[model samples]
Target: GDPGLHHLILDVTQNGVTDHYQLLLGVRRDLPDRLLHVEIGGTSGDPGLREGPDVPEAHLYDAAHDPDLTRILLDDLAAEASVGPLRFRHTAGAGIRTDLTSLPITAEQSNTSLLFGDAYICKLFRRLSTGVNLDLEVNLALTRGDCTHVPAVLGWIELEPGRGARAGGNGEPVTLALLSDYLHTGADGWSLAIASVRDWFAHTPPAGDDEWAELDASAAGGDFAAEAERLGAATAEVHRALADAFGVTTLPAAEVHAMAARMNAELTGTCRAVPGLAPHAKALTGAFLDLAAQAGPLPVQRVHGDYHLGQVLRTESGWTLLDFEGEPARTQHERRALAHPLRDVAGMLRSFEYAARYLIAKSGTVPPEPGGRLETRAHAWAARNRAAFCRGYAAAGGADPAAHSVLIRAFEFEKAIYEVRYEAQNRPAWLPVPLTSLAHLAT
Candidate 1:
């Protein structure tokens, strides 16, 4: 092997504990090797090199961010070439140049995305899973269906299963990365919403109750009502495309009851995990009970399992949704399973609540003294945007989310329960955000 970029799978042992790791290293013939990146769980399902005294200490190198290496990788994919155990798959469409410079998008948490000269973005999955990734699968489907709400899928990279080693116990290739057209002018919905909230907050003075009562989100300069509505429409369009591509199904009464039971079980488990939720558990459980009582069959189809403000982008043309992988904490089978589209609507509504109250949460202050001016303005902002979003969804040929109040409320409670567990374990400070929502539901 020549000195350049290399990917190694290693079984590292420390203090009698062993773990698999994937390391992307930069190597040189005459100089010390460099470690570009490392993933805790190695993508390779095969046994790898064991750590020993002979292991070498490597220097650091940024291989994915290197323009030359990125170009080479793109060229390989364009040529449909197999380099070692890796296979490149390119979609037939517009040709992507291999001469562009590449830089890493640093804001990502679960994956690494490299932007290539504003023309394309390549997302490299950190953890490898058998079967095609949901993001790649859904994006490709949307692209084939001519859905304009998503960026075009250029191609993807995969790791071929090694001989005599079934990929993660199944004889399937593992998806490594996805390449897509980059929206150069796209602004993320989160940033836009935060700015809108900031503007609204500035307009709202920290004054007496009378002045706060007059504060209106629509009157604020950075009102997000219009954008939120358009986003809703765009979301409906994408859902339609998904339903067309991957057929829809109806969950019968039994299944619907089972779904509600699952939600109840989750709520109970979460309350047990976080005792602060105990006071509101009885009230929250009623939403699920109402859901279980529905006699009608409910429609289910592929949905953006994890929909939120951060998952959307506002470009010059309109709203573009990103990341179809769903909730990262869920199993692959669960994420791929069909669910009610209102599940996504509920996710977005919860996001509106987060955006409206995030500034207050960030300030480390108690939730605006429970009905103070700040609290009033936050509620108004969230309510306005939530209504606008539902209006846009209904206007765009989708069922009005508000029309299915029972399902919507149940889903929102389910999402909030998940959030409660997550914040309690990871971020105690942010726990108040979901707690506040739970309180409102309880009342």
Candidate 2:
């Protein structure tokens, strides 16, 4: 019987750029005030304007995927034999788990009901791979490896029953969502970054303030370096674990150079769109080329496809990662592209720049540091973390640090160029986040 998932509650808000359908849903009370709660895209279209998330990625009863093979699945779900008053899947993580056959096939478009309880996070897959899904794969790996920081894989539902966890299901897993213990999280990477920058803006160091306190208090005395160091180490472990699972190969000089060429071309065009990013773009691209030219290319590993602080969680237990969706917009091939692990390092470094500038923009005032200090600080922090990340990375290295350093710098430049376009389109106020990198790159 379908897990009786009855009574869906929905509440949604408009997307930032357009009132268009980016319908977002999340536990309102469980989240911070500034966090933009979202439903990934239940129904994400103007309706009159276009198609969207609220509509469901794939039909509920996909013949190719769904096990019961019909809408009957929904009915069977509601009608599951009753186990007294308790919901059949009541033990399921978060939200209302209903007996499918009981009442109706209800599909919620939005709700405040979720906001009333612990957050129920749904893992939305950008690319559904063959075999055991990566979510299940990682959970299994974590369990086998005895990793504790990651969310426990309480259980997962086979949205398309026959499709998931089945030998015959091959390439058809209905990667809907998983049932893991919800993260009663203290903060996400972005939130912490915003908090850290707020402190910096207030003339306080990241380590001076208590991050767990009231926002104002944290700003008065912020201290994020410890967290930063921990995050770096955690990321290293994650990569090491991944490498243990999937072996790595050394990158070819031709392949590394090819990527550098693509990056350079991308920056050339991207910088022109926003003059502010031009100087930074040039420098960033130059650094990467310089590194590649010298290093003869390093070994390639199965690195985090889209690694970044935003992809992490910060808890007392330590920092952890969420989402293996990879670049979100890139092709599966691109996301899985093997290069210097520095690609991940560079991504995190870019995030610091993103975070620092994002808070300043939100506050509508620049940091107190004048002249090159702001850029210098951005560089210092990025350099510190990059170095810290490298220290851990070096331990796992197939190559030495001095040689990998050049390759990493190049990736950092490449990542920054992507940021320039991202900021120009989505956050003009933060266009400088990438622009800042571009500026540093230019000089």
Candidate 3:
């Protein structure tokens, strides 16, 4: 059955003279008359944060305040929903919070759920791509593989509206959002991980007289060795499932070099924007390109483009991977491209770095450099867990260590460059992370 339409969107594009646009809406495919009714805005484009629904028919009013446009979309959804005015709603715009800084979730995390909370999450992709999201495809594959750490995929929804990207270069249904069961998180991987880090620092003696934090070397509580190993083991399992399901092969040097070049250009751009980061940025990007030159006969398989602690959850049984969705900011195409397993590893390491900075930033005591003090802990944590994640991946996918090691290091450098760009753009206060990270690369 088609996804029941609850919301409608008419991308309003107009010159100064005439303002008109057709509204695309969600509807029950079977029902013709019924529409999902949801109350969103009053007059201005702005609506309150919390939304409420009056009935199943969610309407979309035009900018000029045309109630008829809302009615038309509602009718379309009702027709599509087919369950006879089924109780459902599709929101056009989920109100953004001004002080969302208080929330642990980021703008990127909530993009899908906020609109599809009642029934399903249908992502309306901006940049076009064909077929299904790999996160959706791979996760389904893993669940099909019956891997315990991965969640079971219910199903997938693609735009049967057909290949629109080829026709007029616009206007067709796309594989917008892949819906899955949202994991009810108890404790995030970051908190659980840092607990181990704190325990380690607590046991180890301070390096100097001014040192206040403890340094415990105990692997039992803070060591993260066992868990890291377990994580590695699980990652290996995921990779194994991926290989059996997708198989592995060597990528052409040109393709690898192209990717490496893109990464280098991006990193150099980041450094150029911030003179402070020029030195390390140059070295890191330079090393990343140099390493990319080393690739040959290495296998490329389906990989979690963005794998990290925050992307996973720990339950009573073990660690469960979350969000098959790659970096939300990336295009669906980029997310789907086959790459080194190290891409995921680098992402996890970066995740650790993010967690460390977040902990300190939360305390209002920002680290002078990223990974300077807290990363000391994060590096320990990441290194330990990375090995664990690898063990898991190797066992599961049988990844070659020699090839994987090189690929992973290049990925790590890539992630750092990404961080450098990200921090410089949004949290300039947190730019220290990429700065210090670049220094490590140079040394």
* lDDT per model vs. reference: 0.80, 0.52, 0.54
Best model number under TM-score: 1
The model with the greater lDDT, 1 or 3, is 1
Question: Which has the greatest lDDT?
Answer: 1
Q: Give lDDT tens digits, candidate 2, residues 22-135.
A: 111222212222222222222223353223434322111112112122222223223432322212221223233332211111233221111102433333232234334555
Task: Report the C-alpha lDDT of model 1 over 318-380, residue by residue, as the tens digit.
Answer: 999999998988888889889989999999999999988898889743335555556677888
* Comparing 1 and 3 on TM-score, the stronger one: 1
The TM-score of candidate 1 is 0.88
Error of 3 at 205 (Å): 2.9
- For model 1, give the RMSD to the true fold: 4.5
- Candidate 2 regions exceeding 4 Å error are 1-120, 124-140, 158-170, 204-220, 295-297, 363-403
Give per-model TM-scores: 0.88, 0.64, 0.68
Candidate 1: which stretches are off by over 4 Å? 1-3, 9-23, 29-62, 161-169, 205-214, 364-371
Candidate 1 — worst ten consecutive residues by lDDT sum?
38-47
Per-residue lDDT, model 3, residue 59, is 33
